[model samples]
Structure formats: C-alpha cells, structure tokens
Target: PGAAVVADAGAREGASKCPFSKENMAMEGAPTADGLLAGERYIAMNRFQVRDGSEAQFEQRWAQRKSTLLQLDGFRWFGLLRRVPPTGEAPDFEYPDDYSYVSFTIWETKKNFNSWRKGPAFKEAHGGGNIFSFVGMIVNGFMTSKGPPKPAFWRSMLMEKTSDEKPILRSGPGGRPDADGQQTLDPEVFVSMNRFTVAEGREQEFEQRWAKRESKLDGLPGFRYFQLMRRDQTPDDDVNYISMAVWDDRAAFDNWRNGDA
Candidate 1:
C-alpha cells in the first residue's frame, strides 16, 4: 500500500478541471438554459394568515376542489406550500405563523388564469375568501426569463412526475417560519427552489464545478446556505434536480439575481 501511494501519485497529479464544465457556461442554477423547460412558465399563489383552528377544514376543501381546477384548459402544474420561519426574528413577521398555507398553480397563459378566474369553477374553488376562514390568494406575475428576483420561500408540497400529473396528496403543519409545530422554517429565511436538468454526459462535471462555485459564495455576507437536491423515487421523465438557497434579506437575494453581488 505504501509503495502503491508512490505509484498512484506518479499516475495522476492534481484533479483535472471538471471534464464536462464546457457544456453550458450560463449561471449555475439558471433554469432557462435547459432545452426541455424553455417554453414552460411558472405561476405562484400565496394564501396567508390562515386561521389556526380551521387548518384542517381548509385543507379538506382545497383537496376536494384542486382537481377541478386542473381540468381547466391550459393548466400546467400546481403546488401548496407553507412558509418556513427564520433564524431569530424578522421585523415583518408579525403573526405567530406569518405565512400559513399557500396554493401555487401554474398555467400556460395569463389569459388562461383570467378566463378561469371569471368562470364558475374558479369562483367556487378560490374566488371569494378571507384569512379568518383559512382561505386567501395572491397571484404572482408570470415567471419570465429571469428566475425569482428575490430570495423567498418556494417549495413543492406536491411535485409531479410528468408534465401531465395528478398531484399525490401529502400532509404537514402550518407555514411561515415558526418553532416546532409539525412544520418549521427559520425566521430570517428567504428561500427559493429552482429546477434544472444537466445535459447528457455532463452530470459529473456539473457537480464538480458547482462544488467550486458554491465554496466561493460562502465568502459573501448574508449568504446563509445553499443546497442541491435531486428528487427521490421519481419517474424517468422527471429528472429535474432542485437548488434551494437561503439569504438574509431580499436585497441580498436581488443583488445575486441582478449580478450586482
């Protein structure tokens, strides 16, 4: 073994630059560069201040009705998420659970959502509501070429295997960062998840390259953490890996997205 060490040292010197680094030089986690997802768009909906006691009833109702919304033309994908709390406390996070429950549904067009909102189905599923009743909705504008402009919590309570999917149901506690209440997230947390596909034969290289790039990111201030996760038990067509990152504030997140930081 000792003699083999000398032989191995003579065999290869330093680690070679990731062999597959040349495939796509765009930003590490940018989603638009991948071919399969180019035309796809994202829509995010957030419902806040859900009443503590009514959480069960609220989920029951949404479960009963979510499938109907998917039936609408142009509907793409959907997710329901709860916010995570921060490390210490946030100035804006007033209520115990500042973010409780939210439903994010993606569609093919703004027109698709508009048409559905005005139709009877939308009204029945999500049209009129109040936070006290454990119901609320905030529709974000379409996701353009730029990914999320700021560091914010975005997760898939239910992610699909194929483009056409029937979301399998899962259960959890409240949203918005809070202490151990079945569901927990940090307070100063501004988190977001972006999905990407590594080009064929480039997976190994991409991992090596990201390891180097992420190491440098730690030197910057307010950078909390970055994680790369691949879905488990996923179908063949759904090979998208996720990158979830945390930051101190929106300005810090925006700086990274805008290339200023």
Candidate 2:
C-alpha cells in the first residue's frame, strides 16, 4: 500500500517530464500508456431525467429492448442506473441526484462508437421507434422525459477495482445471473459521479494534484470501484473531467461522506 502511494506520487511528478500531458495524449486503441487510461477504454453516459412515476416504465423500456451491443465490436460494459434517495434521516445530501437514470456504456475506442453508428446494428437497435409510439407515449404521459438527454463521454485516467466484475454488475436484461433472466433491480450498486471543469491550461496541474493527493478510499467499507476520467472536448472547450465512484450501496457512500474519508 505504501509502495503504491509512493509510485503514484512519483508518477505525478514524472508526468510533466513524460511529454504526454492529458491534453496531448493520443486516445485510440487499447491497454497502452496514453493518458490516465492504460488503454483506450472510453466511457459514454446518457443522463435522462424521468418524470415522477415514470421510473418503472423508463427502466422497462431499456430492459425490454433488443440489445445489439454485445454483437458490436469493441463494446465492453453497460449499466442502466436509477438514482437512489437517502434513507432514514441520513441528513439530506448537500446536492441531490441530478438525472433520474443514466445509461452507461463502455467502448474499446472512440472509433468503435463511430463504426457502430454507421453500421447496421445501430439502425436495427432503433428500428422499433416510430412516430406513433412516440406520440402515444407523449400523449399518454407514459415515461415522460423531464428534459433532453445529457450525454457525456470520457477517457478513463485511473481506476481501482476492489471486487471481481466477471465483466460488469447487474446491468441490462440477460444480465449475469446466468440462469434466470429475471434479476433483481440494480444489485445494491450506487454510482456517485462529480463533474469538474478545470481552468484553462491548468488541466495538467489539476490532474497532477489528483494524482498526488492522499485519499483513504482504498479499503473503505463497501467501496467497490472508482475512476477518474477526462471528457472528450475541444482544447478550447471546457476541460471537463469526472470522478466517479461505485459503492456497494448508497448507504456506504453516505457513510464515507458522513465520515472524514
């Protein structure tokens, strides 16, 4: 553990001399030293704000869909997450959940996403959507969306996997139960993500600060996973990045926040 801390510090200092700043790092194909990501693992999430009482229908929409993601090349992981509310007077979170749900997906590279968009799989995936269904859903107030979807894409810079994924957690339909298709809702997993827009030209310094900062998240109870990532944007665009953590449950996160860690 101490050795890891030392190595992380050394990397923080050495990154400036390594010639690859987060800005200049190449973002393409797998497991190589590019940016923070050892490989070209890209993440995409579409946040959707489902109106009150439409949550079930919203989730069912995804659960009932015919997925072609597995058949596509470079598709890695996917998860449909629902925001969890605080339990039993856990002093309300300073900031409440943003969107009601997020469709999280991982790809081998940015190119793979483009390929999927142009290929037949993408078309087939949306083949069932028609104006009639859209009109009906809107008119019937079924699964009404609160707002337009907000999409965010990122390249992972760091991650800590505390438990075995066997690929990923209880996500979409036909999930890892392996026997019965009917899996329980979202498997006690809670995702906490924060967005950061660093000052211009301070991207490297910001990243270094994160690399060197001391954190006691390693062995925190119920901590399952964590990742620091930089979003895809123009150099002049806001230097957006995200720090995402996955816990055994929301209560676990609440404990960490309630405590000093």
lDDT of each: 0.39, 0.56
Best by TM-score: 2
Which residue pairs overlap in candidate 2's backbone?
A: 31-39, 36-157
Show how many residue pairs clash in every candidate, following the order shown: 13, 2
Q: Which RMSD values do the candidates have, in order?
A: 21.3, 13.1
- Local lDDT at 244 for model 1: 55
Residues 32-53 of candidate 2: C-alpha lDDT, one tens digit per residue? 2234434347786655555555
lDDT of 1 at 97: 25
Whole-model lDDT for model 2 versus the true structure?
0.56
Residue 243, candidate 2: Cα error in Å is 0.5
The sequence of per-residue lDDT tens digits that candidate 1 reaches over residues 1-261 is: 000000112112342111111221111343332422222333434333344444444343443443366578877655444453333457346544244554555566646755765576654554334211112121111111111111111222222122223233232222222323333332233555565666755644555565455243454554655555432222123344556555566566666666644
